[model samples]
Target: MLKKLYGKLEISINALESWMKERKNLAGLLVGIVILGGLIGCAIWLNQPVEGEVPTSASQMAYEKASVTAVLEDGAVPDYEDAEGRRVGTQELEIRILTGTHKGEIMSLTNYMSALFNVDVEKGDQIIVRIMTDEDGSYYASLFNYNRGIVLGVFVLIFFILLAVLGGKKGLGALLGLLFTLASIWFVLIPCLIRGIPAIAATVGIVAVTAAGALVLLNGFSLKTLCSVLGCVIGVVAAGGIAALVGNITPMNGFNMPEAENLLLYGADKGMKISGLLVCGVLISALGAVMDVALGIASSIWELHEQNPSLPGRALFRSGMHIGRDAMGTMANTLILAFAGSSLNMLILVQTYDIPFIQLINTDYICIEIIQSVAGALGILLTVPIVAFISARLMARGKRVS
Candidate 1:
């Protein structure tokens, strides 16, 4: 029975290999299509609007676009000021709704000219209006903001067009991989966390799957993919481990992040582990940088081995180490700078408040940022040599055996 099973398994592997070889070009295309289709399905499923019970006495609200029909009045209200040290006032304007149920309906709105959060409008200006109705059917409208979606949409269109034109097939693959990464996080990772799965375990599994899937899709199922995936796994795990250890020993709380207090309140109520989540964040933050280094080292080793198929294992390892050292310099800087950029405002606050050096260093927020940034950089640094060694061994496998 065992022999028969082995025979069947061997036959299945051979058949699948033969089938893939016959449709080599179609395989990558099909993979991309399947991933993209799954992403669209996830988006549709997540965004399906659910009908809720309507409140009978609640105010009705709707957003609409409008065009300023005319400036009816302008005067100083003494409640607001302009940037030029002049007292600003209210401006009343007649406007016509261009969208929503109020299309073509004319109305009037008052704009209080404030230095901030107010839009000064004139005739022919396009604007957004927020309509609110009382239970007695009385309604009021206010200027919401300017219509900015068109500008944003144009920029998005330009980005995709440039990606396609510049990157060709690889660009499509990259886009698909990006979509997959996002879907996995939104659909899989978050849901699992909400369901009370341990954060570290869930993060490790999700990241490993993401790394492998993305690498295979980008590089195909080759030694390069394997090397990169393995390296990423080690790096991410190491980063998480370091974060967990440091967080436990230090006085820092996971509440150092924005909105973390709310999350902690909710998460604690749900029995979620804030410390684990913090470590998970550190792991994920470092993941992209580590994956970059892994890919860089693996590709270099693969290229070197390809050029000298009979190169000695020691020689290949040495070459990989040399390449990794060069990559580590910039990759470490990338991780550190990325963290610093995100916390630039907070850093400025410390300086602005005249925080002492020792106090600033011991502060929970700054310490958390330091741990996250340093741990991630350390992960990248470690992944380099690990990837270099593994890739060299695997790429030089046949040569070494011969």
Candidate 2:
């Protein structure tokens, strides 16, 4: 039994050593470690509490934690139509403060359920309450979001479990890459933007980092991964350039984007560039598709090279180009369909309004979607040849070395 266990361990170690024998693999491993470390650092930084005031002179205002003691069966659920003609309900509840200056105090609160913003509460439920004191010493408490940490935790656990079961080690790597990307967005990119960093520059930097991490994790430290990274970067740059050109040539400004007005209003004091941010948004949206195309083409070419190791660089490049052309058709349709799906509701609304084709096409939303789809498709097309050439050249060089 001892001999068998030792033999298996030796085999595993040997396999691992063989896998890391290549310098490229060692470098990729080091880069992955650095990215993961950066992600952890960002997580620690973002975990710190961020506090801000509402810029009010009211002295007695406070946010408190509370627990619902009772549902107040006497509460009336008045039937009413909201601005959207949708019916909503309201409920009153009795709650006891769990924390803050009002700890142990009982209060009657109203819960308004709207089609847009609402949360249901039950007995013993924990919630956040915003307590505001009037000039006359009277105080009121408003119900905020309930404590949904457990739900979120459960959702995340399920996701990881599914990923692990389906993907094994590869899935774990993908998860790590995903976490790193998200951390970069939430910690690095957003903070930089908030600090008045140029939106285009910050976005491009983050996109490049994300692409590198994802490609390396997915494809490992090989010529394929290198080719994918190069292709993805070029595709992202192309997409960003196209988006900028379109935004500049067209009358569409940042205001045409959803949440643009809100961002502008909030960041007015910070002087955030809403237009550049809008272009950044388009660039980010198209990046995923571009990366997908790049990796697919790179992997396909790498496999071709592996199968025909004797093939010259020119033959490999030609084969890659042929494969890329075939992939371009489906990938372009995929990008268009994805964009179209997201704008389906808006399209339906436009059709319902009986808008003319010319006018409909001229709409800001429609035009933005069109630009995103076209730019992403163009990026994919561009990435194919770039990846093919790079992968073929690298593979041929490696073959000669071997």
Instruction: Write down the TM-score of every candidate.
Output: 0.77, 0.78
What is the alpha-carbon lDDT of model 1 when measured against the actual structure? 0.79
Colliding pairs, model 1? none
Per-residue accuracy of model 2 over 183-262 as CA lDDT, tens digit each: 77887777667656788998898898888987777656766777888888888888878877887888665778877777
How many Å off is the CA of 129 in candidate 1? 4.4
Query: Candidate 1 residues 89-142, lDDT tens each?
Result: 788889999998879899998887765665767799889889988779888789
Candidate 1 regions exceeding 4 Å error are: 1-71, 74-89, 93-105, 118-137, 264-273, 399-402
Off by over 4 Å in 2: 1-24, 27-67, 74-89, 96-105, 114-129, 133-139, 145-149, 400-402
Query: What is the lDDT, from 0 to 100, of the residue 239 in candidate 1?
Result: 88
Distance from true location, Cα of 161 in model 1, Å:
2.2
